[model samples]
Target: MKEDAVDGDPFTTRDVGVAYHAYSASGDVTAPVVYAGSGNPSDYDWLTKQGIDVKGKIVLVRYSVPYSYRGFKALAAEQRGAAGILIYSDPAEDGFKKGRTYPDGPWGPESHIQRGGIGYDFRVPGDPLTPGWASVPGAPRIKAADAASLPKIMSAPLSWRDARPILEALKGPDAPATWQGGLPITYRVGAGPATVHMRVQMDDKVRPIWTVTGRLTGTQSPDQLVIVGNHRDAWVYGGVDPSSGTASLMELARSLGALAKRGTRPKRTIVFASWDAEEFTLTSSTEWGEQHARDLAEHAVAYLNVDSSTSGPDFKASAVPSLNRLVVQSARDILDIEEGTPEMLSNRLGGGSDYTVFLNFLGVPIVDMSFSGPYGVYHSMYDNHRWMQKFGDPGFVRHTAMTRLWGVMALRLANGDVVPLDYRASADRFREFIKEAVQTARLADLPALRPLKAAADRFAIAADRAGLRIETLLAGDPPDPAAAALIDRVLIGTERAFLDSAGIPGRPWYRHLIYAPKATYAPEVLPGVTEALEARDRKQIALQVARLAAALDRAAAILDGSR
Candidate 1:
């Protein structure tokens, strides 16, 4: 890899570096560059509308979009006949436009490059060679060349400073206003005079990675499980990414250990997991989940994930609706370290972390939380303890707060007689999703969504009645273990109802009907409906819609104790 000189001097070790996609095949090529804004699906469509052909070119895209969406961009570029892909972080989103540059503030500097894996994770996330199964000792393996999720072309991350010369040399029409970034040069969609060479050399071989697990057995319901996890790997130092979460997990384990020493063990089994290779492709956790699928499906109650636990002070969370009430209650109980007030957790759903396997594949109710502020030095060399102490959490208060929140939530889930899942809230959330899906589908002239709306309404009624019955039972004297057990069965089975054993179209690994990660602007419920509609496959749209309705019906029947 080569980069332009800066300040009449070539790049030193501090300024010159590259981050490549995992499993990127070794290659050497030189081609003209094309600027595709954000490299989203719509952005590609925009490039088409502007009559710019990226075929046989080196594509340049900004890293403003979600990490889950980055691979889609690379795949899209490959399909369009691109020779290679270069990704960079624009100052508009994470640098000077947001705040001061790094060395002065928390934002990224021109030399701070964001590096990450470029696997097409929305299809399947794990070791590329071992899909749909655990990568265990002597496991059945496939050839690395046959792994469909790996990138078909070379790809790397570039610092914006290194990218400026190539971008400025391009000759093309001015980009749409929104396509313009915070760079000083005039942005253009390029097929350029800026030809450049690219190469990615990687050793494709299986290696050993460890997932550290610590278990505390329950006193009464030893079979019921509550798991907490954070990945241990990083692109570089990872101070604000996994390391922050890793520190919080360590603190949580210590706290829980102290509590256990005082004879306060949880009522249900609690597991603490520090996963490895998550930055590469969610390898360790996914493999572990696959290895223990049967046990987890039967015994696991919930999974709480803390990735990048604190970059700031605001409390943010993403979870399945059944866990919403528990998360809110937990947040309200913990005071924010910076604000000195009860934290208010905000909910959204999108996948880019270790929660994928537990939530999407296993149907285990999961929640991921972080106390995030302005974190711009993501995946860069600058994300070290020095940066963390100076800009991220000076007093480590946010880390302590995250530990408390995680420990308290795990304790509640493990010890509560009546599992704190709220199906009524799930129903309400489903209704919202159905309404939005219907609105979006109608705009696209899709009529297959009617049945989904009807099913959501039916499910809502059943969920409400079930919620009332559970509340009444909880209020009764000497909580009936049998009744509580029955409710627990229903709660656990509800998430499974959304699973389609055959999996989503094109992406068989993600079977959940409610949530699946995609390259969309916002998370969609019944994701297959939108995907099918996008493909203009009326038959597939109808099929997915009917299956979603059937799943909802199944959930309702289980909650009503009819199944």
Candidate 2:
């Protein structure tokens, strides 16, 4: 609170103030703040069995339990019947030994609070009114009550300054070490022998979502499309989580748009989207893509996601393996980092922010562009303009760099003689998926297990065979147009192969290779079919990989023959 700490920037101080303001405005007061322990689905059931009504009640829960995002399950609890949810981060997990807190250093301070929605479920994401289909204005709307699911309203952070008052009031047995936190008091899971009350009221109103788009139409294959996007929204002054990355995206758009204006249009249409509601689980883009699903699948060459960038020590990318080489080539052109390979930069798919809908449901080959700048101020009041300016990107150099990279990749995809989708890499990745499929099958019921395993084995063989052929084709030379188109179509078919028209167990709208059960903080609501379908889909995926591989091989043969 010192004058010098203000740093002469109004946004920095304002962001800090805004963080406190959000906490004060959203906190609940009337209901007894009972502890739901971990806040999982089973916890909800246990509370019900104990005759404790969570509906119309304010529940206080801790973060860093079995589930990183407690809001997801808690929101589902609210739908089942709970009034308000308050999630506080225990000091034990993210404080002290982890490093210094904000103002002191980077990690969240004692007073810092993490505010987020409990709206996103892993099942699917988009306009609630139109589940599987698009949400066009005149589209028939599903009633809110009839809507598939409800997320509990909750927020969290790594602080005891914000948690002290609530934890002091609760009375219960000593918490297990796993449940214990850094707080001075003996941790206890309580429905309150002390009996604190909590109350919450939200506007529950829909806000206008903005999606700034710029298009570059290709000359040779105008209908074939390639899209790249980044989100602009943040919890507070999200200088790190989104703004940093979004700025890069805007730079890319400017660069690409400038190129088109200069009469250097690509061969396929390229679009850039600055999406809204990404913090709330990709609400804007998912709805837009879902609405335009058919058209998108038909024309979409690929979808690239650029999110959460910073002046990092390193650059990382997680993309559909098929595009591994392409991403690497592009990144090396733009960045100075030595860890140059796309395969090196790329990581696995897990829950956090965007890219869920595109890859999980729609089957769009998604590439998550990430920049890990230090993890000191993540989800804290310190994650403001000041932090970014000081430790992040002061000169906006990285922003400019990423923009250029986006332009290069978009141009490559749009203007290439053939959509450069490499199926050998795809086949190789599918083979890895077979291992995951078997793991999934092992978790299934006995009746479904054998069939699933059989399917997985079949897929494993197909993927291995096809992957080898595709690699051979690529190693040789470029392929004929027809063969290339076949490869492209086969890549496209991989996405559709995993979709079940019947949808996930509950929510039907999301159909893709992976399953994302809707969760609050982790809201990429895509559901893969049951364990039984795992093997079957595994096999189907291999077949699709093979199909693309064969097409690419044929194309290579034809190109060689012609030569």
Candidate 3:
């Protein structure tokens, strides 16, 4: 952990530093540090309206409610001409407000500083210099200055201990109720004498990253595949963040290897990968996904990701709706550590994992598995073995459960005669996404959503027809290989049809029209339409709705024909 402290705060050097990929201060930046609530654009806008401009001033923001990613906070501050940003965790967010803190319970200690990269990977993930393409041996590259995902302004993280002095020093208007944090001091929106020198210098360099892969070729069709992975890299010693999952991945690999030795291998190939640099930029996985884009598009059935396998005892999963049956089947087979009952699978996949590339970029069906609970030590040194053993995953029973669960999910896709992708749930979810966005944005008068709704309805009917056909084929005494192949193609095509080569309007690297990462790294369904609605740009909204409606129509037609 890099040490962090202010000139005025004379406590032990705090353990925090400027975030990865953020511009560092030239030397000591002695300036007035103003408080901006959550560092959101609206926060700055409010400051501007109140005649308190933030230009050339350092901003001290809390990691509080209305959860935008820290990178988004950095960008927001940069947008308003802030000289630098200091993001510190408020106890209400992930500290004693939750429960007893570290060394006592699962929450973070006063010293804990959440570490992470501030890169805008949601726009275009992977290597900044190699945006859309895979960065293999000699992949084409661009200057970091020209890269779309890189941050421009200086930034750093701070523990509340280090930030307390500065927050206490502020003199300004009382902050709104929502802007109050769990700190003892009263919150304020300031442009006062609370100025302090903020210094940062970084060693910005590109290092080699590796993605280790080993494929177990199938007996029936080696060309067909199922991919599974866990990211090996972590911000620190990521006990609950990734190492827990990494340990589970190793156990799963061993079990699978033993099965293969016994001459019981998957009918379709299983490619197991441990990706590097995932925590920083989600780099290695994205590169692998891009490098094999063509092959994956043609033959890949599903991707299973294991991340944070056990932080506590609540079993959870995130997946595309199309994989509901597969997830349900796998859950029924695995035992939950808490109740000793069948594990439960949660809802739609989010945007920040290795699966982002597979599902959003390559249109592969994906499921991300986890066992979560009070995980406040995320991205910190506190997330080490002791924390995991004492609080996260005591007895490591959950680890074994994860191993079995991960293997079972991968096997279901790899060994099944027919690709186990179903689109009925997907269609339902798509409609819900559209309706929620329209209602939330109150864009009921928007004209184009009518076609989008009709297209979604048609797609649902088509999905039912396709499901019926698959059921009959699976029930066949011996389904015709040619017919089964065609059905599988349609099933996979349903997912691929969601892709628009031009990508979500501004962020083309994220080609999936239905799902893409929001600027805050949250999963955005109907991303194109959702973003347009946020802008309240009717013409752009209409264009996005039409593009999505066309994709839905294309998916429906494929299902209709297969039936």
Question: Please, what is the TM-score per model?
Answer: 0.93, 0.79, 0.93
Q: What local lDDT score does residue 495 receive in model 1, on the 0 to 100 scale?
A: 82
Query: What is every candidate's alpha-carbon RMSD to the true fold?
Result: 3.6, 6.0, 3.9
lDDT of 1 by residue, 1-563 (tens): 33222232111225434566665657899999989988776777888888888888899988874343567768878888888988888888787888886667898878777777778776788988889999999999888678877888788888888778887998888878997888888998877878999877887767899999998899988898899999989876788889999999998898898889999999999999999999877999999999999999998999999988888877888888888778877877785333223344433466778889998899889998898888888887777776788789999988988898999899999988877888888888888877776776645554677888789889998898888888888898978889898888888778888888988888889888889877432455678887887777888888989989999999899889922
Question: Least lDDT summed over 10 consecutive residues: which range in candidate 3?
Answer: 3-12
The lDDT of each candidate is: 0.82, 0.59, 0.81
Which runs of model 3 end up more than 4 angstroms from their true locations?
Answer: 1-28, 65-67, 336-347, 438-444
Candidate 3 positional error at 361, Å:
1.4
Tens-digit lDDT string for candidate 2 (1-563): 11123345466454344331121124465655566766667666666676666665566666653346544645554665655666766656555546775455455556556655554445556665566666666778777656543443434332466567777777655545655667777765565654554434445555567767778777867777798888888776788878888878777767777777888777788888888877665677877787677887677878888777764646677777657777888877677444354345543455555566666666677677766654545555567777776666667666667667667777777776556666456545544554454455434333433443444344445445544545555564564556556555555555445555555445555554443443533323112423324445655444433333333343333322311
Q: What's the CA error at residue 171 for candidate 3, in Å?
A: 1.0
lDDT winner: 1
lDDT for model 3 = 0.81
